[model samples]
Target: MSRTIKHEEKYQQFTIELDGDEAELAYACPSEDVVDFTHTYVPKSERGNGMAESLIEEGLKYAREHNLKVKATCPAVAKYINAHPEYKDLLAHP
Candidate 1:
């Protein structure tokens, strides 16, 4: 199923509401042009449904649009970046 992801800048997270529960990918901006993906959470019922991938994609897209490099501190986000080489260029230098 297609889901609508919402970026809540105030909360520094991307979220999707599913079956009245919310799945979120939280992030932090430590520098002017860097976005650090800090955590990802999917409701138990929402797991295995690509909710985390969707949030990661949206978060990366947002960072790209705003010309921000990415730092994937969250394991899920790091795994996604590793699996998707297309997004590797967006990673911030270590």
Candidate 2:
């Protein structure tokens, strides 16, 4: 199914509406050019549909477009980054 991911800059999160529920990926910018991916939440009924991954992909695309680096603090974000080496160059290391 096609879902639209909305970037809520004021809330520092990306959200997707699915079947009357919302899935979100929260992030924080600790610096001018760094975004820390802090949390990912998908409703139990919405799980296993790759919504979280879609959220991350949208977040990463935003980061790249804005020339910001990413700090994968959320486990799901970290795992996605690990599995997708193409995004490694965008990582912000300590």
Candidate 3:
């Protein structure tokens, strides 16, 4: 299925619309330069299709473009960044 990830600034989430269903990765900015990824949700029908990964990748790209550090509060996002070492530099430091 074709999918497009979009940043909803008012909601602070990256979302994908598929077949009229929505999957989103939510985040919060706790500081000027840091964005904390708080949650990810994909409907059961949309699961196992890598939609969440696409949302995370879009979020990461947003962070990079904005020059913001990322804090992966969501377990899946943390794991994704761990597996994709190239994204490690985007991690926020305490």
For lDDT, the strongest prediction is 2
Query: Can you list the residue pairs that collide in candidate 1?
Result: none
User: lDDT scores for all predictions?
Assistant: 0.94, 0.96, 0.94
Lowest lDDT 10-residue stretch of candidate 3: 13-22
Instruction: Show the colliding residue pairs in model 3.
Output: none
TM-scores for all candidates: the values are 0.95, 0.96, 0.94
In candidate 3, stretches whose alpha carbon ends up further than 4 angstroms from where it belongs are none
Instruction: Report the C-alpha lDDT of model 2 over 17-71, residue by residue, as the tens digit.
Output: 7778899999999999999999999999989999999999999999999999999
TM-score pick, better of 1 and 3: 1
lDDT ranking from best to worst? 2, 1, 3
At residue 45, give the lDDT of candidate 1: 81
Report the alpha-carbon TM-score of model 3 versus the true structure.
0.94
Misplaced by over 4 Å in model 1 are none
lDDT of 1 by residue, 1-94 (tens): 8989999999999999877789999999999999999999998887998889999999999998999999999999999999999999999998
lDDT of 2: 0.96
